[model samples]
Target: MANNQENTSEKKKSEKKSEKKADKKQPNKIAKWFKDLRIEFKKVVWPSKKTVINNTSVVLAVVAGAAILVGLLDTGFLALMRLIYQ
Candidate 1:
């Protein structure tokens, strides 16, 4: 029927329009990503210098403690191996 044909053609035209609209949005995706990144960066709360220094000191102290523990364990294991083998 002519009506069916007209309806089908109209559907095809709308699909083409939608496809073109989607194509136009491709370039905006990168711009939108950077804009969103800038907005999120603005929302970040940075630590103060004193807070940073305190955190850094805590981290270094923990690292030093762990290193000493590992060293002691290593030395004890080596001494045991020497006593067992010799």
Candidate 2:
């Protein structure tokens, strides 16, 4: 019975030590994460102004073309329906 009591006391001491170590490490972990994020952002490649403008114009042209095509199809369908009903 005495040996069992000693063993339980030793386990409790070790658990408290581990909990203190974990508390100290929490701030270090957050600092390391922010440091890694800054390094990763430095490695990123950004697009140039000319390249961005070219891609934007291409997207706008395609959208305008699609809109015109849909409008034409809608008008043709409406005319056909009118003729059939008359």
Candidate 3:
């Protein structure tokens, strides 16, 4: 009878442990995602305002240059095609 009581208690303890593990496994995903996002954002190194503005200007300039180059190429190709068809 004592051994049966011990076995029942051991089974209950194991059941409690498994419950705890199951609870841990079912974490609130949204809370976990926000927690991970906060941790990652904390790790980021932000640039200075002047550096950001300078980089932004550089990007705009490059984009404008690329647009102009593409426009010129398209116009030249259109003119060449017109001459060939005429």
Candidate 4:
């Protein structure tokens, strides 16, 4: 009986210690998270104005090419449908 009571008290003490440790770290964890995010954002190398303009032009060209290709395919498909349905 005494051994069981001692074990229960010991368990309670350890749990309280764990709770205190977690309470102490709560603010530190948030501060550390923000610090890490700031560091990661600083590490990013943003594109220059010239590079951005060149990339934009390339994207626009690709979109135009795809649009033309799709239009042609659609016209051919419509012709084929008309032939079969008529």
Candidate 1 to truth, TM: 0.73
Question: Top TM-score: which candidate number?
Answer: 4
Clashes of each: 0, 0, 0, 0
The residue-level lDDT of candidate 4 at 19 comes to: 100
- Worst-scoring 10-residue span by lDDT in model 3: 22-31
User: Candidate 4 residues 1-86, lDDT tens each?
Assistant: 99999999999999999999999999999999999999999999999999999999999999999999999999999999999999
Predicted candidate 3 versus true structure: per-residue lDDT over 1-86, tens digit per residue: 99999999999999999999888867776679989999999999999999999999999999999999999999999999999999
Q: What is the number of residue pairs that collide in model 3?
A: 0
Please list the residue runs of candidate 1 whose C-alpha ends up more than 4 Å from where it truly belongs after superposition: 1-20
Candidate 4: Cα lDDT at 82: 100
Residue range 10-76, candidate 2, lDDT tens digits: 9999999999999999999999999999999999998999999999999999999999999999999
Winner on lDDT between 1 and 4 is 4
lDDT of each: 0.99, 0.99, 0.96, 1.00
Better of 3 and 4 by lDDT: 4
* lDDT (tens digit, per residue) of candidate 1 on 1-86: 99999999999999999999999999899899999999999999999999999999999999999999999999999999999999
Model 2 misplacement above 4 A? 74-86
List TM-scores for all candidates, in order.
0.73, 0.70, 0.64, 0.81
